[model samples]
Each structure stands twice: as C-alpha cells, then as structure tokens.
Target: MATAKQPVTAPTVISVDDFLAGNPDERRRADAGRLRAIMGELTGEPAVMWGPSIVGFGSYHYTYESGRSGDAPLVGFSPRKQNLVLYLTGGGLEERDDALLARLGPHRAGQGCIYLRRLDDVDESVLRQLIERTVQVHRGVDGGSGR
Candidate 1:
C-alpha cells in the first residue's frame, strides 16, 4: 500500500506562488508543472486555485444528511510537503481489480483521495485514466453525479 510521507504539521496554507517559491528544487517545480498539465488535459477544464494549496478544476455543491452543505472542487490536487494528494471527489478505487487504478503505482485509496509520494512512482497512463474518469463523474456523465 502506498502511503503519504510525513506531512508538514498544521498544513501551512500556501498560495500558488508561495508553494512554488518554497520549492527550491527545480524538480519539485517541474513535478508541479507536469501535474498541472495532466489536470488540465484530463479535466478539459482550467485549473483553479481553490485555496492556498489546492489546485482544483470544476466545481459542485453538496448537502450532507446532517443538513450541512458546501461547495467543493470536482477534481483537484494538492502538493503537500511530504507527498501529492490527488483529490478524487468522484470516488475511489475498489479492490485491486480496476485495470486503470491497478496500474497506478502503489497507492492507498480513500473515498475521496489518492496519495502518492512522487509523480515518477506512478504510472502516467493509469493516472490519466483516473483523472479522466473523475472529470466525467464530476460532470455527471456517468450514472452518479457530484455529491
């Protein structure tokens, strides 16, 4: 199972520029740039900085059973200090049967997240499929719509 490396505690909020600025390593900056490209290609939407750290694409609103409702990005990603957090608001991998997800490098799938230590560790094809599927989900192209 893939797990996130140690994350910066308190999760320092970061603007896009600040995030890039903090990465002294050119590789990190390149990784982020690659991710942005993939997100745009997969989602067919322009990426938006949802908050300080999260780069999101698309949008939707949801209401919980508790009557709590909020707006969230349809698909998004975050470059945490320790790892990359792929926000799959659409859903998560089920078991190890899914071809696309299985191809993704070792990863731990939660209901709404896919954690990765590095971009090089993941299979580009699989990652692209996941992102494409997720974008469709967010757009209600599949049976289930956004929550």
Candidate 2:
C-alpha cells in the first residue's frame, strides 16, 4: 500500500504579523506590509503563514503528470535577506504580458517567481496587475490552460 505524501510546504497556524515582523531589515518589513495590503485586497484573503517564511494569501491544489500533488498559495511573497521573492502560480511567467514585464522596472523573473530588490523599484500598478493575473489563473477564472 502506498502512503499519501504530504507537501513539504504547507500552511501553518503562525500569526501573519509575527512572521512578517521577523523581516531582517526595515525596508523588507515595510515592503512586506505593502505587499500584505496589495495581495490581501486583490486576493480577498487574509495573509497566512505558509511554511516557515512565506506570507501567503490564497491557495490552490495542483497535480503533475507524475501524479504528484500538493497545495500551494495562489499568490505569495517572501522577503528574503537580499530580495523580495514573489511566488506566483505554477502556470509560469511566459503567460504574462510582455509589455507588462518590460514595464515592471528592474526585476528578474524565474520559472514561477519574480524577484525584486525593492518594492519601490517597480510600478505598483503593474505589480498589482501581475498579482491579479496570478489570482485569476489560480482560481481558473482566466481562460488559459493554467499550465
């Protein structure tokens, strides 16, 4: 018999305030607060402590071709020592609008995350749009395959 595997990162009962307060620098803490507000308003979900470090908003379940499955945040961010890393949907960044990325200010996009050194570096409206897209993708509201 096979056992049901659990995801390595899952939501915890940790207080969102407490987790956010742990930011190592003042800038990160402030940026985290701004993100909490933006993501909260966009997702209509309160921030939750996902795993030990991520301040996540909503969640979605996913399965791969290998049959491995787990739940993940619809949108989230982690204020690391060096960068504010955003965990967008697994559908990846290719689906994002090219013009938007071009106007997103100085930042780097990963397979499913966007990294920025400072929130002040980007256009807030564009960031919000990217986040809104992630929420839409995870909720299956967007007509894409949500790959």
TM-score of each: 0.76, 0.92
Q: What are the candidates' C-alpha RMSDs?
A: 8.0, 1.5
Model 1 misses residue 89 by how many Å? 2.8
Shift in Å, residue 33, candidate 2: 0.4
Candidate 1: C-alpha lDDT: 0.70
In candidate 1, what are the lDDT values of residues 48-71, reduced to their tens digit? 777667877767666766776666
Regions of candidate 1 where Cα sits further than 4 Å from its true position: 1-18, 90-98
Residues 1-147, candidate 2: write the lDDT tens digits: 999777667999999898888767999999999999999999999899898889899888777778777788889999999999999856548555568878999998877889999999999999999899888988889864444
- For candidate 1, give the lDDT of residue 80: 77
Best by TM-score: 2
lDDT of 2 at 136: 91
